[model samples]
Target chain A: MLLSIKNLHASINGKEILKGIDLEVNYGEVHAIMGPNGTGKSTLAAVIAGRDLFEVTEGEVKYKDKDLLKVPVEERAREGIFLGFQYPVEIPGVSITNFLRTALNELRKYRGLDPMSAVEFLKLMEEKKKLVEIQSNLTNRSVNEGFSGGEKKKNEIFQMAMLDPVLAILDETDSGLDIDALRIVAKGVNHLRRKDNAFLIITHYQRLLEYIIPDYVHVLFEGKIVKSGGKELAIELEEKGYDWLKNT
Target chain B: MKEIKTDTKEIISKERMIGLFEKNREGLFMTDSEFMSRIRKDAMERFRELGFPTTKLEEWKNTDLKASLEKGYGYYLHPVIDVDVQKVFHCNIPHLDTAIIAQLNGWYVSKDVPLMELGNGMILGSLAEAFKEYPRIIEKYYGKYADFTSSGLTALNTAFAQDGIFIYVPDNVSSQKTIQMVNVIHHPESIFLQSRNLIILGKNSRISLVHCDDSYNQQASFANIVTEVFIGENASLDHYKLQNMNNDSTLISSVYFNLEQAANLESHFISFNGGLLRNNTRILFNGKGGTANVRGLYLMDRKQHIDNHVFVDHANPECTSSELFKGILDENASGVFNGHVLVRRNAQKTNAYQGNKNILLTDTARVNSKPFLEIYADDVKCSHGSATGQLDSEAMFYLRQRGISEENARMLLMYAFANEVISKISIEPLRLRIEDMVKKRLRGELSVCEHCVLHCNTPERPLEFDIDVTKI
Candidate 1:
């Protein structure tokens, strides 16, 4: 198993967000957590990514059988845990090339590998840029500064491709993207999928699941997983709506 | 009369300053013209009446200089020490070819002579020597733009200042090499020094000037320096002021600029480290169609304090002026940015803008920013804004999530913040050098060195960023 959570409990500022959550994932699996707004979907992703804002009152999160909560945010990232932000930050004066090179070099250092040369880094950036279908000269610009909704998402996936994390958790990556951008983003994700890697895609809608099929779907309502099923459960929920899950 | 307070004692008092001026009237303040002596005498009397500013004054409210003023300092009556120019100061800026002008303590020094006359009809030398060599030019422009009556420090500098840098550019001529004026204070004991500089740009002339103030050792010192610049019709001047002093030093520098018809000016002030620094910058649009852009950036940490007071007077019509100053204060450091723009009644079509931004790294780090515009012209456009806050938390998390350490993330944001002002540097080599210094400064690795700001600590080495972001 790549990731395992046993009765994970977390809260922010004394307001309990995730009351009790249990989940398990192995390599070569895609897990989609579908829920309504304000249902602790993002909070769960943030806690697993080592955000210090939330306090895990009880339970435990283990990555590769080690305590995941004890690791720092950057250490989690170096351990191949990536979280694509919902709203990508606009960092002025930090070019995309420079931001990625620093990130890649740090990750390489963690794994006891030599830092990539400028020529090699630029070459990898070019390859990743094509996978996301980013046509503009966005790599030379500041990170997400003045980028459109579609461009920011594409840049996130571009970063995902560069890092190649083992367990990728994307928070609402398909919310603001258009159809063409949605297809490009889904294409990038599908191309980067491997047997040894896993993904935890959190979304408010199931429209994105149609493009990149998830092996298992969990309906989270009121901070607990109410229903768990295969891909067919997504279509049933798409037709029946989430109101049924509230009563069940 | 304003009541002045002081605790740190055993230093020169106002009465002693008056006695020193009277005693050295014949020897130190010597000049051929009687008018010059009268100017010096009047300035001394003004200093006696105004005295040093205390916390009671509105302008000195945030910065209290009582401790700095109380330090016991050796005030010299003349340049009694000789320093070998080549041995004391070394220029190590790689590939930056500039004509160097050195000033030791408060007096100018040279290898051959005190003055140098270039082939393009430009003159560079000591201000005291210029009093006898170019008497008419000195009489026409010296002490004309500086406001000695209002600022007591300016009055004191004007009264005791004897030797500094002097530059003159003839009409229709421009300098081929950028002139770098460096003032190095290397005294064994604590000292109080005052230096005065006068620069004149004739009609249709252009010049680029880099003025640096550096302290060699960690000795406590107080420097009261004043500079007056005059730009003739259709002339342009590029000015840069770089200051890096010891933690126990106090520097109070005031520069007054007068621009004539269709003149242009761009001045940048970059201060790295100091105990207490106050930069009084004043710009006057004396003629029509003159434009001035004054910008500043200061990086301070520990218990350091920096204050910048800028006043722009749009006295003529069809003039434009803009002020943008940014600072990053860390630990218990404090900073102040007060920008005032005045547009007169007849100054129609005048446009003025002022903006000040700061980022305080800690809860104890503080900044007071005030942007004021007093406009009497109904047809003019003026705006002012000031903002002070911490770094964006979202950006911090985003960088951390990308596998960057928190330390490197903070450095990237700070370097980005300070780069807004440094990117405007027109000279490529100077801009690159400043970029390296600013990076080193953000990492707390830079200190008061024995050479110029352009002098890299390790020469002949390619600049590299720690986070592998150098190409950008």
Candidate 2:
């Protein structure tokens, strides 16, 4: 198992969000978590990413059989956990290339490995740029500064492609993206899918599933996975909505 | 109100000055021309009257110089120890192509043994030599802008100052490489020294100068500096002052700019470390169609204090001026920014703007920012704004969520805030060097060179924070 969560209850400022979330994921699988508005979809992603904003009151998380709850955020990232932010931050004066290079070197140092050479890093960046179809100017510009909404989302997926995390969480990556941009983002995610990697995409709509197929679909309503099924479940929920799942 | 006390120490200082004047009276060169003698005399009398500014005065209310003034610092006419330029300061900025002029203990110490003259008809040498050679030009703009009566520090510098930097750019000539006037104070004892600089830009000419003040030891010292810049019509000048000294040093520097018709001036003040740093900057629009931009950035920690006072006189119509100053105070450091923009009655269509922003990192860190606009002209457009706040917690959390360590995240955001001021640097290499220095500073990695006295990284006790890894 790549990730295992048992009765995970999280809250924010004395208000509970994820009452009890128990989920398990295996390698080489794509899980689409479909939910309604304010159904703890983003909170689940933040919990998995070890975001300090949410307090985990009970239960535990295990990543690759280690106690993931005790890991720091940056250490989690170095351990191959990536979170694609819903609203990417604009870090002025830090170019995208510099940020990525620094992150990569830090991770490499943590793993007791030699850092990537400048030429090799540039080549990898070139390949990832083409894979994500981002403008060349973005590599030179500040990270997400003055970027359009679509460009910001595209930059997130581009970073995912560069980092190549083992467990990647896409928290509303489909939001605020046009159809063309959606296709580009899905295609970038699909190109990076491998047997050793898994994805848990948290999104509200089923429009994104048309491009990238998921093996399993989970209906997350009121902080719990009320229903779990195959890919067609997303289509079924897209038509019937979460009301049917909650009532059932 | 407490009266301005003429202490016994000040009297001794004045008597020492009179004694020094009598000692150098033969070589005083008073007979060279009456123009130079009158300036020295007027400045001497003023210094006799107003010894030093007092806290009772409204201008010196925030910063009390009593701690620095009562030290009874010894006066030094020259370096008490052997002054070897190479051994004292071995700072050669990597890849920086500057014709460096060195000054030790307020005396010009050059490498060429005389003066440096480029093919572009520019002169860079000792001010004492310039006074003997170009006395006419020196007399025309020497004591033109600085008011000797109000600022006793300026009067002291004008009266007792002997040697400093002097650069003269001929008409229609531009300096190829930026001239770096580096003043290094490495005295054996706690000393007091005054230095003066005179810069002249001819019509349609240009010059970029990087003026630096550095100290070697941890002993206390006082540096009183006065620089006068005369910009001819259509000429442009880029001036940058880099000040980094030991925490036991006190520096009082006054810079005056006189802008002619269609002339432009850009001045940047970057103060990295100091004990008590005070800068009085003044810009006068002597003719129409001129513009001046003055900006400053100061990073201070510990018990450091910085005071910057700027005044831009829009005495001519159709002139534009702006001032932007930003400072980051950590620990118990305090700062004050007083900016005044004056537009006279006949100065119509004068556009002026002033801004001062500060970030106090700790609870005891404080800043006093006041932006004043005194406009007598009816048709002038002028505005001023001042803001002081802490770093944005949201911005910090946002960066940390990207998997960057907390320390690195804070450093990145701080660098971003500081880059807003450094981004205006037109010179790429210089900007890059400054950016690198700032990064090292933010990371607490930069340290003083064993041989160089320009900058040192004092090892501070590790800062402790009660940060909850489980909660931001």
Candidate 3:
């Protein structure tokens, strides 16, 4: 198993958000988590990403063989964990290239490997930019600064490509993306998927899932997984809506 | 005379002493020497008559100097035998065509400046040398622009100034490079040092002046400096002053800029260190079509106190002025910013904008900002604003959610805030140096990751971030 969560409970500002979330993902498997607003989907992703704003009241998150909670957020990323934010921050004066270089070096440090040379890093960046279909102009600008909605989302996917992780958490990455961008991003992700990697895709619609084609579908209702099934479950959930999970 | 009880005795005495000036018999008459002796004596008499200003005085209320006076700082005359002037004086930019003046302990040392090549009726030399060579010009502009009524510090500087730089750019003669004046303070003993600078930019001529002060191996040294700038009609001047003194030093500098018709002025003041610093910049738009852009940046830590007071007077019509000052305060540091824009009745169509912003890194740090606009004119566009806050919480959370540590996230946000002001700096080399200094300061305060240092230290290098959502 790539990731195992047992009875995860979390809260924000003393109010419980994630009551009890139990899930599992295997290598090479893409699990799509679909839910309506305020169903604690984002909160679960945030907690798993180790955001300090939300406190995990009770639960255990096991990644591989170690307890992921023991590591810091940056360390988690260095340890092969990635989270594509729904709204990426704009760090002015810090160019996109500079931010990624720092992140990549940090990951390399955790793995006890030497950092990529400037020549090699640029070569790798060029190759990955083609995968995500991001323009060269955006890479030279400040991180997420002055970027359009689609460009920002595409930039998130671009970053994931730079820092390849064992477990990738796409938190509402499909939001605000056009059909062309969606297809390009989906293709980029599909190309990067391997037998050693796994994905936990979080979205509000099944349109993204139809393109990415997850192996399993899970319904998150009020923070806990209410139901789980194979790929056909996503089509059923799209047709029936979230009312069935709400009543359950 | 009634004495006000205060926590600091030094402050109270400075305030009460200004009143002593009024009792002197010589109101505006000369009393001390030949060159500026009379003017200095008259100014001293005025200063003594007025004593030190109190909080009741509108301008001096925010900045109290009573403590500085009460400390009884001795005058730093000539340098001691143990001092190495060369080690104490260093110029970061040396290739400029303009002359360079180096002063040590309130005295003019040997100058290797290339003033003779500036043959277009330009006179760049030591103030004392100018007094002997061109006494007429020295007497004409010296002590003419300093205001004794409003500024006791200016009066004190004029009265006690020993040696300084004197620059005169003749009409229609544009300087090829920037002139530099380096002030080196090496007095270890508690001493008062007064330095004066006079810059006269001729009509239709352009020049750049850069002044930097270095306090090396100095303890308890007090520097009181006054720089008077006179820009003639249609002339342009770019002035830069950088103050990076020792933490134990105290500095009180007043810069007076007088602009003529169609003249343009760009001035930048950067203060990075000082125990207690008070800077007063007063610009007089005396000519029509005159424009001034004033910018400042200050970083304070420990118990340092930095006060910046700016006054732009639109005395003539159709003049424009813009002022922006940003400060970062950490530890128990305190900052005071007061920007006043005054547009007279006849100065119509005067465009003025003033902004002051500060960031407090610690709860103990305090910032007092007051931006004011007094427009007596009918047709003028004037606006002033002041804001004090900390790092944006939303921005901080956003960085953390992306797996950056809280410390690195804060540093990034602060760099952004400081970059807003630094980005406006036009000089490329100086801007890069300032950026590096800012990064070092941030690293000293925060636990920056090694990877971050590797990425940020690679000057001018760019990085790339690719996001492929399908994989993750």
Candidate 4:
């Protein structure tokens, strides 16, 4: 198992968000959590990424059979847990290339490896830049400073391609992306997918599911996984809106 | 009515200054020119009337120099130190070739002659020597720009300062080598010194000047320095001021800039460390179509205090001025930025802008920033803004989530913040050196160097970082 969550309960400022959520994922699989607005899909990703804003009141999370809840945010990142932020922050003055190189070298150091040379780092950056079809000049600019909405999503995927996390949880990565950007992002994810890694993608609409097929789809509503099924279930839910699930 | 309490220290300091002038009138300040002597006397009268600035004044409200002034500081009226000039100051800037001039305490020190006449028709030497050699030029511009009547410190410096760096660039000549002036203070006890510099750029001339202030010891000291720069019509001047002092020192540096028609000026102030530093920078556009870009970056921590007061006078039409000053204050460090721009009634088509931004690391860290603009011309553009805040928390989380350590993440953010001003540096070598210094400062590793910054960082020991900052 890549990640295991047992009866997870979380809240923000004494307001419960993820109430009694249980989920499990294994390697070489893709799982999509489809939900309506205000559902707990993003909160689950935050808890897994070790964001401190959401307090975990009960239960536990296990990544690769280790107690992941005790790890720090950066430590979790080094342990191959990547969280694509819903709204990427604009860090002025920090070039995208610099940010990525620093992040990659840090992960290497955590694993008792030497830092990457400038030449090799540049080569790797060049190779990864093609995955998202980002222009070479875009990497020289500040990280998401003046990037369009589509560019931000592509940058996120570009980062994912560079880090190559064991388990990637994307929080609304397709939210603000246009159709072209959605296809590029999905293609980038598909290119990075391997037999050893898994993805837990959170989305509100089924429009993105057509590009990147998921093996399993979970219907999340009111802070709980109310229904879980195969890929066909996503099409069923998309046909009969989430309101049907609420009525049931 | 608000009652003003009399301060005994201010009175004593004022009286001490007056007594020093009376004692050194004939001996230390003996001048051959009667006009120079009269300028000194007039300055003394202004000092007696103005005295040292007090907190009661609006400009000095945020900065209190009473603590710095209370220290018993010894005054040196002459050149008392005789040390090896080359051994004392070593400028090791890689690939940066500059004409170096040194000053010990307040008097200019040189191993060669008192003045150097370059083949390019430029003169570099001591101000005292210039008073005798180029009396005509000195009499024309010596006291023309710096307004001693408004500032008591400037008045005191004008009366007491004996020897400082002086440069003269003649008409239509472009200086190939940058002129570097290094003012070093090395004393065992608390000391007080005054220094004055005068630079003249003739018509159609261009020159780059780098002025550095460094302290070799930790003893308490107070420095009152004044510099008058005159840029002739169609001339250009690129000026840099790098100040790095120990925490026990106090520096009050007032610089006056006079620009004629079509003259251009770019000035950068990179202050790394200081105890109590206040920079009084005033620029006057005396002719039409002049442009001035003044930028400053200061990084201070501990109990240090820094204040920057900039005044721009658009006296002629089609003049433009921009001021951008940024600082990062940590611990209990405090700062003040006062930018005042005045566009006269007839100064049409004038564009003036001023901005001050600060990031306070701790809640106790504070900054008082006031950007004011007074425009009398109806056909002018003027704007002013100031912002003070902490590092963005969202950006912090974003960087940390990418596997960067908390410490490196903070450094990256702060570097990005300080780089905005550092990027304005036109000199490549100086900009690179300042980038390294700023990085070391942000990491809390910048120690008081043995010499100035240009000589401090040798090529052998480059800064080590786990992450590559060169790309940033």
Candidate 5:
């Protein structure tokens, strides 16, 4: 198993968010987590990313035989766990190139490898930009600063392509993207996928899965996995809508 | 205590004028005896009358000068050690063709500037020389920009103003490189150094001037610097003041900029060091069609106390001014920022914006920001705001969640906050130097961050890649 979370429970501000959640994903597998608003899909991504706001009361999250709970968010990132934020933060005066370089260097340090040279880094960025169709101007500008909804999503995917994480967690990556941007983003993700890589795609809409094509689909309700099945379940959920799953 | 009082009395009695001659009696260019005597007597009267502004004064309330004055500082004259003038020249940017002036202590040391080579009508020399060469310009513009009645310190500076660079650009002449003025204070003891500078940009003339102060010693020293800039009609002036003195030094600098009709003026005041520093910047849009952009960033740590007071007076119609000042205080440091924008009557259609933001890194560190806008004109758009808070906890958590260490994340955020001002600097080399200095200061190192391995990583990607990255 690439990622295994057993009976996970988390809370924030004295209120429970993730209640006894169990999930597993193998290498090369793509898991789509579909849930209604306030069902703790974002909380799960935040917890997995090691965001400090959510306190993990009871959980066991193992990534490649190592306990993921003990790792910090950046460390989790450096260890090849990527979390595409639902709402990317705008960091003014910090260029996209500088931010990506810093993140890449940290990952290199974690892997005991030297950082790529500026020449190599630029070449890699250029290649990745083409893959995600991100404008060169956006990379030169401040991180997520003045970027439109679709552009920010594209930038996130570009960052994922640059970092090349082993387990990619897309948290509502499809939220602000149009159909064209969605196709482009899904294409970028599909290009980045390999036998050694796994993806846990979280979304509120089943439209995103139509392009990314997850292997398994899980319906998350009230902070727990209420149902798990094959990819056909996503179609069923999309047809029936989230109300059916909430009642089920 | 008795000895201390006696020493303080002795220091005050001499004043800036008496101290200048006493310190530089053997200098070669001390021939203007009558001028010296008059300036000395006038300075003495002003110094005694003003008697160092106290906290009781409304302007000096946020910055108390009691501790700085109690130490009793003497004017720095002559280099204590041999300084390579060539090395200093080489350190400056080469593309700038403007005249360069170097001052050691309160006396002019290097007057062999290439001012004549500067095409068109431009004068860059010592204030004493300017007084002798161009008396009419000095009489009309000097002391007219800054109000001495409200500030005793201003009066004292004008009275004791001995050696300072005076740059005058004639109409329509644009300077190629910024005029670089290096003020090196090597005072190893508790000494008070006061210097005055005057810059006048003629109508339609464009110029840039950089004032940098670097100290060699760590002993207690106090620097009182007054810079007055006059921008004429349709002229443009870019002024940069870089203050990175020793930790034991106290710098109280006041810069007054007077803008005329259709003038464009941008001033950057960067305060990155000093023990107890207070900077007051006053800008007056005296003529219609004037625009001013003033920005400042200060980094304070340890017990350093930095206070900034900026006042923008929209005195004429159709004038605009924007001010943004940010500070990052860590350890037990304290920072104060008071920004005031005043739109006078008859100054209709005036546009002014003032903002002050501060970030405190530690629990004991404190920052007080007050931004005020008083407008008498009805048809004007004016806004002022002040925000004082710690680093964003959510941002910190977000970065930390991404596997970056907490310390690195904080550094990144702090760097971003300070870069907002640094990135606005138009001068490339100076901007890079300031960025390096900020990074070093953040990492608790006095040296440049680029050379430190702990703060900066060694280039793994060859020199070519490094150059490309630098270009980007």
Candidate 6:
């Protein structure tokens, strides 16, 4: 397994957010986690990204046979784990180019390599920007400042393409995006998909799964996954609301 | 009588100033006309009555100068001359194009070459020379703008001030080059010095001045300086002040701006490093359709303390004034920002705004901000706001999620906060230089920045933030 979480438990502010979450993933696979609101879907991704907000009281997150919870947030990124934030922050004075360069250099430094040249970085940014079809010039602008909802989500996908993480967890990346933006984001993700990498897409509805084409889907309800199935389950859930699963 | 309070703590500087004045009475009054002497005498007597402000006063409530005043300083009757001025006080701003004037130990250092004489009757020289050559002009605008009765420091500076920078622009003339005043305090011991500057912009004239206060030595010293600027009808003045001094220094600077009809002024104060700095900025819109924008940014750490007190008086209709001040405090450092805007009864259609924002990096760091708007006119739009808080946690989390370390993320946010005011600088080169300086300050790189002309030290703790403010 490329990543594994066994009997995971996490809480914030004395309130348990995730309880007894068990999941496994391998390379060359796209796993979709579909859940209703307040089901701890975002919390799971945040914990995996090493956010200090939650305390993992009873859990073990194993990545590449190492204790992933012991690593810091930035180190997790260096170790090939990326979390696409649902709401990107607006940094007023930090340009997009500067933020990305600093992040990229730190990851390179962790891998014991020289920092990328400015030319290389800009070229890489341009290439990745093509995947998301971002028309406006974002390099000179402050990060996420005054960006439309669609543009912010697209920028996230663009960043994922640039970082090329082995295990990418995009937490609710499809929310607040229009149909065209949704297609553009999914296209960007599909372009970056490879046999050596994996993606965990967290979404609320089946609209995005049509484009991303997840091989497996899991239903997370009230901080626990109640059911697991293949792509056919999504269509069934689309027809029958989540209340139908409560009877079983 | 206002029942002035006098104690031993504040009387030391006053006594020293009066003693120095008595000793140098002849030399001080050497080139003075009767009107000038009478102005000086009135200021001297006012200083005797007003004395130094105490904590009881509303303006000095947050900042207490008891410790600074108790320090024993050697008073100076004259600035130490005979040293090589050019070699010691060389202008080091890289690629900055400006008309430079150097002041050594509170006295304007006369350049060997002739002073700048722009055609159209614009003259830039020493105030001492102006007293002899242009007495009528000096007597007209010298003490006209500065309020010496309320501030003892201003009164003291006016009384003992013998030589400083003198700038005059005739009507319908505009200076092509920005004038830079480099005031270098290079005394050997703990000395108390007072200096005054006079700047006059005639009708339809324009000029920009970059005034910098730099100290060359680490010895303890005190500086009480006053500057009066008069902007005639339809004139414009862009003033920039940069204060960089050692850890054991005290600087009290007061600037009075008098603007006439349709006059425009943009003033920026950037205090990068200092021990104890108090800036008293007063602006008066003397006529209609005038606009004044005053902005300040201070980056203080360790034991440094900076206070910015701004007062804008809209005495005429259709006048606009705004004040924006930002500060980043680390370690045990503290700062204060007090902005007051007053719109008189006849000053209808006045637009006034005042804001102060601060970021406290450490638990021990402190900041006090007060914004006040007093309007006697019902047809005016006046607003005031102040904010003091820790860094935004959501922003921090977002940055860290992208793999930026906790340290660098905080630095970026601080620079961003201060940049809001810095971005308003219209001059490109000055804006860039200030941007670089602000970055160096945020990174605590001033101690290690070899290319930086300003020299300073950094503490060991390096202003680390409490990054675990995640509420959820």
Model number with the top DockQ: 4
- Candidate 6 CAPRI category: medium
By lDDT, rank the candidates, best first: 4, 1, 6, 2, 5, 3
Answer with 1 or 2, whichever has the higher TM-score. Answer: 1
Q: Compared to the true structure, candidate 6 yields what TM-score?
A: 0.93
Error of 3 at B195 (Å): 1.3
lDDT of 6 by residue, B101-174 (tens): 76766777753632456667888878877887887898788889998888888888888777888899999988
User: What is the TM-score of model 2 when looking only at chain B?
Assistant: 0.89
Q: Write the per-residue lDDT of candidate 5 for residues B1-472, one digit (tens) a residue.
A: 0111012222433354445545544442255455555554565566667767888887777777776666665443322323334433334333334445666565454424423325577777677677777778877777777676677777667655666667788888998866777676654356676788888888899987877765645667777888888999999988887777767777878889899999998888787777888888998888998999989988889888999898988889999899999999989999888888898999999999999999988999998788888889899998888888888887776565455678888889999999989899887766766687788778777531121111123322211111111111
Reference interface contacts recovered per candidate: 0.69, 0.30, 0.43, 0.81, 0.52, 0.72
The sequence of per-residue lDDT tens digits that candidate 1 reaches over residues A1-248 is 89999998899999998989999999999999998899999999999998899999999999999999999899899999999889899999898988999999999999999999999998898898899999658898999999999999999999999999999998999998889999998898899889999999988888999888999999888888889999888898889889988778
Candidate 5 lDDT, A5-60, residue by residue in tens: 99999999989999999999999999999989999999999898888888999979
Instruction: Report how far off residue B410 is in candidate 5 (Å).
Output: 3.2
Error of 1 at A88 (Å): 0.8
Compute DockQ for each candidate against the true complex.
0.74, 0.33, 0.36, 0.83, 0.48, 0.69
Two-way TM-score contest, 1 vs 6, winner: 1
The 10-residue segment of model 1 chain A with minimum total lDDT is A133-142
Q: Is candidate 1 or candidate 5 better by DockQ?
A: 1
Candidate 1 chain B, poorest ten consecutive residues by summed lDDT: B463-472
For the predicted complex of model 3, DockQ is 0.36
Q: Candidate 5: global Cα-lDDT?
A: 0.78
Please give the lDDT score at residue B107 for candidate 1: 75
Chain A only TM-scores, each candidate in turn:
0.98, 0.98, 0.98, 0.98, 0.98, 0.98
lDDT of 4 by residue, A200-244 (tens): 999998888898899899999999999999989889988998988
Lowest summed lDDT across 10 adjacent residues in model 4 chain A is found at A239-248
**Per-residue lDDT of candidate 1, residues B200-253 (tens digit):** 999999999999988867888899999999999999999999998889989999
